[model samples]
Target: MIQDNIDTTTRQPIYPLLAAFAASCLLGTLATDIVYWWTADIIWADFSDWLVSAGVIVGWVTVIVALIEIFALRSARFRQRSRAYASAMVLALIVIALILATIDMLVHTRDAWTSVVPWGVILSAAVAALVLVTAYLSRITDAPAAIEVTG
Candidate 1:
C-alpha cells in the first residue's frame, strides 16, 4: 500500500507555522495598541516601552520553543526534522528582525516614514543566527527545529 511504502508520520511544513506566527504578531500588535490606547489615560508611567519589550520577549520565546522542539522532542537521527525546525527558527528570527527594523524606522521619523536599516534588528539577527550556528556546531538536539536556532 502507498501508506505502508511511504512515511506516514511526516513533519509539518514551516511556512504555515510562520504564517501563523506572523498572524499572531499582527494580532498582538493590534491588541497591545488597543490596550495601551485604552489605558493611556489611566496607566501610571509610560509602560508602552515595557509592552513593546514584551513583544520582543514573546518573539524570543518562540525561538526557544522551536529550539526545544528540534533538540528535545524530535529524534536526533532525523536530520530533516532538525533542519526543518532550524529553518523555522531562522524564518521566525527574520520576521522579528523585520518587525524591529520597522519599529526603528518608525521611531527615527515620528512624522514621516523612512526605510532605514535597523541596526538593532541586524544585531539581533546576527545573534540569533549565531545561536543556531553554535547549536548546530555543537550538534544540540539532532532534529521542527523551528523556534529559531537563530533567535
Candidate 2:
C-alpha cells in the first residue's frame, strides 16, 4: 500500500538511482576510452584509468543533480532530494579512486606502507566517513517536522 504522504511523494527511488550510476559509469568508461584512443592511440591500454572514469561518472551525476536542484527543485516530484546523498556518493567514488591510486603507487615500488598515496587514502577515508555522517544527518533533517494535534 502506498502511504500517501508528502515525504513519500518526494522520496528517491533506489533501483533507478542504482541504474543511473551503472549507466553513468559505463558512459564514463566509454568516453575516457574514446578520448584516450584519439590522443594516446591506445585502446584499453590503461585499465586502471577506469577508476578515474568512475570518478568522472559520479562527478557528472553531482553536476546534473545540482543543476536539477537549482532550477527545478520546486517543480520536481522528488523535491526532497538527497543532496547530501549525491555529494557523499561522489566523495565515496573519490575515496575509492584514492585507494586504488595508492595501490597503484605501491605497485611501482618495493615499499607499500611507506608510500604517499596511502596517506591520501587515510585522509580520503576520514573525509568519506565525515560525508557519510553528514548524509545521514541531512536525511534526518529532511524528515518532516512532527506536529501535535491535541484536541
Candidate 3:
C-alpha cells in the first residue's frame, strides 16, 4: 500500500466566518433602516447605527485576513480551489462594501430621523448588495477542486 501526495494543510475558516458575519450585520442594518423609515422611530435608527458600525469593524478584520491569505499564505490547494479572477472579484466587492459601510456609519451619526431616512438607507442598501455579491463569489470560489491523480 502506497500513500500518494495528499496535502493535509487545512486553511483557517475564520476569514469566511467573519466575512459572513460582517455581511449579515451590514444587511441587517439595511433592514433596520427600512423599519426606521416605515415607523419613523429613533430606536430603529440607533439599531442601524450600531449594526453598521459593527459591520464596518468586522469587515475590516475580514479584509485584513483576506489580504494575508491572498499574499502570505496562499496554499496550492487554495489556488486549485479558487479561480484567480473570481477571488480577485470577491476581494474587490468586499472592499467596495467596506467603503459603503464606512460612509453609512458616518451618515448614522446625524440626527436620528434624518440619519436613516434617505442617504443612510441608500448607503446601507448599496453595502448590503455588495456584501451579498461578495458572499456569492466567495462561495463559488471555495468549491472543492477536482483532483486529477495520474499514474
Candidate 4:
C-alpha cells in the first residue's frame, strides 16, 4: 500500500538530491586528493593516506544516502518509507563516522588528525543525522493521526 502511495506522487526530488550529494562528495574527495598530492609526499602508497582516502569514500556514500532520506521525507508521498530510510541512514552514518574517527585517532597524531578529517565529511554526517532525527520524530507523531484517519 505504501509502495502504491509512493508511485502516485506527482513529483519527487529524492533521486536528484541523492545524485547531488554524491557529486558533491566525489568532488570533495578529489579535491582532498589533489591537495594532498600537491602539499605532501604521500601518493596513495602510504597506509595512512590510503586509510584517509577510504574514509572519505565511505563518508561520502553515507552522506549521499542520508540526503536521499531527507529528500524522501520532504516528499508528499512515501512519508513512512522516507522516515525509515532516514533512520537507517543515520544509524549507518554514525557507525561509519565512529569507525573512521577511531582509525584516524589511532593512526595519526592530533596534527595529522586535523589534516586528515575532511570538513565536508563531518558536515555531511552531521546534516544527515539531524535530518534523520527530525524526520523520524515527525513520522512517529503523524502515525497516530494516520491510524485514526484510516480507522
In order, the Cα lDDT scores of the candidates are 0.41, 0.39, 0.76, 0.42
Best by lDDT: 3
Worst 10 residues of 2 by lDDT: 142-151
lDDT of 1 at 48: 30
Residue-level lDDT tens digits of model 4 in 19-57: 334334433443453455456644421434444444455
- What would the per-residue lDDT of candidate 3 be over residues 16-63, giving only the tens digit for each residue? 667778888999999999999999978999999899999999989978
lDDT of 2 by residue, 1-151 (tens): 3444554445443322432453344334434344444455343324324533454345455545544543444323224366444544544554454354344334323232322233423433343344345345434544211111111
List the candidate 2 regions with Cα displacement exceeding 4 Å: 1-53, 73-116, 143-151
Q: Look at candidate 3 and tell me the lDDT of residue 112.
A: 69
Give me the runs in candidate 1 sitting further than 4 Å from their true place.
Answer: 1-23, 26-51, 75-78, 81-92, 95-151
Winner by TM-score between candidate 3 and candidate 2: 3
Provide the clashing-pair count of each candidate structure: 9, 0, 0, 0
Better of 3 and 4 by TM-score: 3
- TM-score attained by model 4: 0.28
lDDT for model 3, please: 0.76
For every candidate structure, what is the RMSD over all alpha carbons to the true structure, in angstroms? 11.1, 11.9, 4.7, 11.3
Local accuracy of candidate 1 as per-residue lDDT tens digits, 1-151: 5653243245442533533453344334434334444454323112333333444555555555544645565533445655665555555554555465346334423321111123323333343444345336334533333222221
